[model samples]
Target: MISLTNLSYYLGSRALYENASMHIKPGQKIGLIGLNGTGKSTLLRLIMGEYQLDGGTISKAGDVTIGFLNQDLLSYQTDDSILSVAMQAFERQNHLQKRIDGLLHEMEVNYRDELVDKLARAQDEFAALDGYTIQSKAEEILEGLGFSTDDLHQPLRSFSGGWRMRVMLAKLLLQKPSLLMLDEPTNHLDLPSIVWVEKYILNYEGAVIVVSHDREFLDNVVDSIVEVSGAKLNYYSGNYSFYLEEKALRNEIQQGAYENQQAKIRQTERFIERFKAKATKAKQAQSRVKMLEKMDRVDAVIDENARVNFRFNFSTQPGRHILHLDDVTKNYGEKKILTHANARLERGDHVALIGANGRGKSTLLRIIAGTEPTTKGERRLGHNVSFSFYAQHQLESLNVEDNMLEELKSANPTKSEAELRTVLGCFLFSGDDVFKKIKVLSGGEKSRVALAKVLLSQANFLLLDEPTNHLDMQSVNILIQALDQYEGTFVVVSHDRYFVSQIANKIWYIEDEQIKEYPGTYDEYEWWMEERKANPVDTKTAAPQASSNSNGKLADKSEHNNSNGSVNGKKPVSANDEERKEWQRALKKATQQSEEFEQKIAGLEKQIKQLEAEMASPVVVADGKKMQAKTADYQRLKTQLDSVQEQWEDAMLEAEKLEKKLG
Candidate 1:
């Protein structure tokens, strides 16, 4: 365990932490959260002794060991395989194994009793340390962090920065130090990897302190929240969601106390002003002045939540079909990214494309944007459709010499300076901050500028590839709000679950070399996926009788059968007349049931929307009891809606199978 006592740290003349105190307990999972530049990562370094604290103490037990996983480790390079790198954590066992090998080698040459005795002792220690299973342990950890078994043998220098970072993380986890410190661990992770890490951290035996902006990751992994604000560390004894609710209540009480203190001060000042000149009340007035001077002033609460208020508009209204891909085939050398994949994007569609790494999400985005050529396919854009693509690499396309304001001006030459400034302000660049040159901005700052430019592109269709990268929680929330209010169609690729859930109404994933669609929110899609995993469907047996042709039209099965009742060189059995009649009756009943389920689903959706509106009402929000009741009601309705939706989908599938059989 480690404890920071009255910690005070400064960067030049600016104080990053002033009298910030936090005691990390054994086996505790803590999340360090704050706005960018608030020194969340800096605190971790201070604890690691990389930086000298300006004041106070960081004390830990002499036996305690620490393992830090940071961005700086991304530059690590070696020819050794990642498996070897990770197995290096077992230093004692490795040394013992080497000793055992040396003793055995000596005995082979000299046949000495001493060598045999030494070899026996070394082997015993190695076995006690579980050295024999070290390689397997390293492999499991590396693969859990998203590496393939084959990738474990690749040279560490052969991987990219992000993948290398994962290797370093695997090494640290294998170390099993007393205290684990991770800075932005999820930044390079995919959704599945992130989930894996969360589960791993939850069951870890050691203490953990993570600095991350990922809300859902924090909610799932951390048991306590430590917020850095106003040069001090504020502790919350619960997860991120609990911190938000507790902070709200604390701010409400603080605001009231501040107002009351202000009122009291004003009254005392007025009394002093009126009675100071009078002979009878002069002493009392002077006493009251001292009391006013000595009173502790209550600090007003600072609102950290920022809202996006600018309107995102385009000049043209797109046609009903925004884009279409027919039998699209894309390949890079021997790698097949997409093979005969067909998909359509319509007007007003908000889609989130997500999956594990190397699924070609960005490649698909570029293909949709018409920037990447297809090996064999047709991509058609609807009438009046204008589009803009945003990605992390686009940051390099920015003019570093230009200031943020000038960059926005270049993005939209028609918008007035005032309008551009307002847009920048919504992105947290206000007043003179907008005058800073792009070259001087940090990665997060550059990301905000690029996002602002994309919003101002005046395109009805947007393709965003990892737009949430390098953004803080507040910035992510602001982008979500803007996207929520946007009427234009968009397909975004992101690994941030909370951001995707908030902005996207539809979910898309690549499976079996084809783009698959789920007509629901990310949360709903996740639930459906879980259901499928729990009760997996066998696609080989579930294939429908009718299939789509290259033109995306349904091909009749009868066309493939001969008049002699032979299909594809196989004999077809004929059903009895009564059986035929029974099949027809069943198909009719299934179709009607499917139709009824659709109507019920529609009604449930309407009711859920009404409940959402009610929960958002000002009156309900102001009353704690009423708000709680409304929230409970909303959750209940959502659960019901999910059940009904599942039922409806099953009914439709059943109807489809019956129809296919009859045809």
Candidate 2:
């Protein structure tokens, strides 16, 4: 729907985009990605016409509508309820509703035919526009973005900045513009909300251009990738994973070309140097020199991946048991965060504490660090267990007047200046960058500095809270590598799935006011969670217990059961056999019913699509009677589709329950 050709933009003397060209086709999902300061957000503003382009043109269809969700919307405040704010997207319907209200009020006094006709026309138009269901649609989008139904009626000004950003996102989604641009949309969302948004974007009919550092989110939603690098917009035909492989191959080819070019130049220069003194070959040498000078040079590939070369070591090794929480009960006033929660951390445990927002992940991390007191619990640390807590607020603890090098020195006075500088360089702060004052650094820069100090603290146990916030993909990789190499135990709270998957060997989540542990990698954990969802059981009564296998690793108790109705070594009784047969029959019946319903739902959906197309035909539109008749048929098919979908859902749930019971 929009095309940018030979675009050039500059910030004073620095060129952000030079002759960059990109075409956004209709119904395309594009993920715009780059390291910080590569002009991703600036490009969004350039598209939105907030900034004047120095050169080239950005052309769009005259009727193309655009909706942009950016960080700037965080400052928007109003006394209207969030529901009302979201429903404001239906401008025409809202205005018509107001006029209808005015006409109806006039009818109470005058009762004229004109007023009655106006009200009838307005009502007809409202029904045709689906104005009556606008509020319900707004509410659905808002709730899908993580707002509770009760919170929808609250004043927009009462919410926090992140929540307000979600409200703006909901409003934009409701508007359903032809082209949507979102800047770091996942930054304000939790894991569940992010998943919801991914599904929504996958089914969205309009074009989408999203700027994000979230790899999994991009991989799941976008059909194409756009990399803003070296003042050019580079296109990739696939998602983030494909882009990584493709970029690596391209870099290999470029590096080889660059090397061959350099070698040729060196050989030519040597020839000129050796032959220029001889009178016979001087003319030939001059020609060779000119040829070398006129040759187009190949640009060397710049490696952007930052590596963590410095080893993270602790002064003292902790005991096998690093920490233990026994019957931990934590509360904030009337809110119960944790109730009788028990967990243990060993010296080698690499745990990821994850859940939705406001589930006490950070609070639990602080409690583990012994910085926050519990309502009723005992938190104990093992021998030689030195712990360091890292949180966003720790950035504020840094002395603003001190330079980065000085800050690291303050964190550990014993480390030599060379050692400190080496650590800083690993964090992408090289040479004179260490001399910059902390006050002048950006949020991501400050985060890197804080992370560097945390690594230098020489603590055997680390409690990290949202450590990946404000970090780019490369910086997150650096932190992941550093954590992977560290010999100490750590528990981190982060929403970045890629980082968590890279660093964590164990997963921890809060459910039913208690900490639950899953002993596996993130990918395995996700598979297990999906299986659990498909075969859901009552978690309160049938929680899976961890058991040790022959390899001495933790495995689920269900894995220990034998195939022939035996657990451990005992066989089931005759009564149990009859019960199993009954369950088997029930499962078979349920599966059959579910399959039948799915087929019916598919048929109804197909009929609905056909009716919709028929109703939209020019022949039907030209004849009012035919158009009305087709619309009625379309509505009838739509109602049938809805009913069939509900029944299919019920059948699926029933089949799942039966499967769970049989298992």
Candidate 3:
């Protein structure tokens, strides 16, 4: 457990935390959330001792161990083999094991009793730490993050930045510290790795605090929500989704009180202004004016103004035939990155390219974007095709010396200063901000600036590689809204499920080096997953691990620590009776606001039923236009109703399970 007692931090004239008090109990998963540049990362760094507090103190109950996965981990790279780096944590034990082995050899040769005793003590310590499971744990953690057996010996330099982040994650998991602080940890991870991290955190002992823009990720993995704003921290005893609904309701209530107070003040001011000039009620007027002047005005809180709405603008209409790939083969020496892959992309298609990390998702995106070529296949871009590529590693493309304005103009020559600045403003680049050099921007700022450039490209087709990286929640919402309205084609490789759900109309799932298409959003992909689970596929045997896992077979999940202080394989939480109880308790707390989530869901359900009944009624059939309108209304209602229904069911089950536990 960890505790913060009247902790305060100041940067120049601004105080980040003013006597902030917080408590984190064991077995609790906390989500740290706030607007960008609100010092969420700084607070974590303060706890991690990367920074010093200007006032107050952060108290600790005993020896506390902390591990952090910061955004600057991209620099952790080397030509050294992967396993060697992973085994570095066990150096002391390894050295002891080696010394014991040498001692045993010497004892056998010289018959020394002292060497035997030392060897016995070393073996005992090693066994106590679960040394036997070290290899299994290392392999499981690495593979869960999408490293292959062959990749085990590969040098760190072989990986890209995103993959390097995975390596950093592996190192932290290997350390197994008591307090794990992850700031936007999911930024560079693929879905598979994200899921693995979620599971690992769910089961991890001690406490976890993750800062992420992925709403669903935070909602599923975290138990408490810590909202830092206005130089203080407010704790909500639930996940991000729960925090959102609660905060919204609380704000609405506060707004009402503020409005009422303002109205009273206004009335008193009006009465005093009119009555002050008249001798008839001069005494009363003086008292009224005094009350108005002395009253402490209730300041209505306003939302953060930093949210922006920049989006890609498309000009050329996509051709019916957008792209074609036939018998494509891409290989790195003997290791095949892609093998005999074939696919076609049509105009106005919104596709998601999914696979385990390092399975060539970005490679295929680049190939489609025409950045590179396949070894044995033909790739074709149709006529009138104009596309933009948002690189997974975009920083490499930016010239550090170039200012924000220069960077935008360099991406596309046709953009005007006025037009470019107008668009850049949406990403919070304004006035002198546009003149700031790209190298001077922070990671989040650079990410937004890169995305701003993509929007100004005016391409009809977008090929994005993890486009949501470094974006805040508000920025992501703005982008999602833009994508929903834009009449363009997109092939986005992203791990943010919420982002994909809002805009993706089709999917191209890449697994085992093959691509499969689905006609709906990413949610439908889950149906495909369930089907595959019901009809299991033996991927290792069926395709020899050469082709992709098309059906997305059920992956085995397991967890254990080796005798030598190493965690074994990872596993998903099964939500048995006990686990379900925790979920229910959280749900119960979430539903206590004035406008209960259950009531909203019920109201929506009623509306949907009414709309369905009316649309189905024979009377509407007589008027073709009216019938069509009714049908459309019915469909819209059904979608909303379905979403509400899912939420309702989850909350009810969780509540029921917790109620029982409490009883």
Number of the top-ranking candidate, with TM-score as the measure: 1
Clashes of each: 0, 0, 12
Mind giving the per-residue lDDT tens digits that candidate 1 earns over 238-314?
Answer: 99999999999999999999999999999999999999999999999999999988999999888899998899998
Off by over 4 Å in 2: 277-280, 541-543, 546-663
Sorted on lDDT, best first, the list reads 1, 2, 3
Worst 10 residues of 3 by lDDT: 543-552
What is candidate 2's lDDT per residue for 366-414, written digit by digit as tens? 8887788645887888655799999998899999999999999998898
lDDT of the candidates, in the order given: 0.86, 0.85, 0.75
Per residue, candidate 3 scores C-alpha lDDT tens digits across 176-260 of 8788888888887778888888888898987898999999999889999998887888999999889988988888888898999
Q: Is candidate 2 or candidate 3 better by lDDT?
A: 2
Report lDDT (Cα) of residue 73, candidate 1. Answer: 95
Poorly placed runs, candidate 3 (over 4 Å): 78-80, 155-158, 271-297, 304-313, 399-402, 409-418, 537-663
Score candidate 3 by TM-score against the native: 0.75
Per-prediction TM-score, please?
Answer: 0.82, 0.80, 0.75
- Winner of 1 and 3 under TM-score: 1
**Model 2 root-mean-square deviation:** 23.6
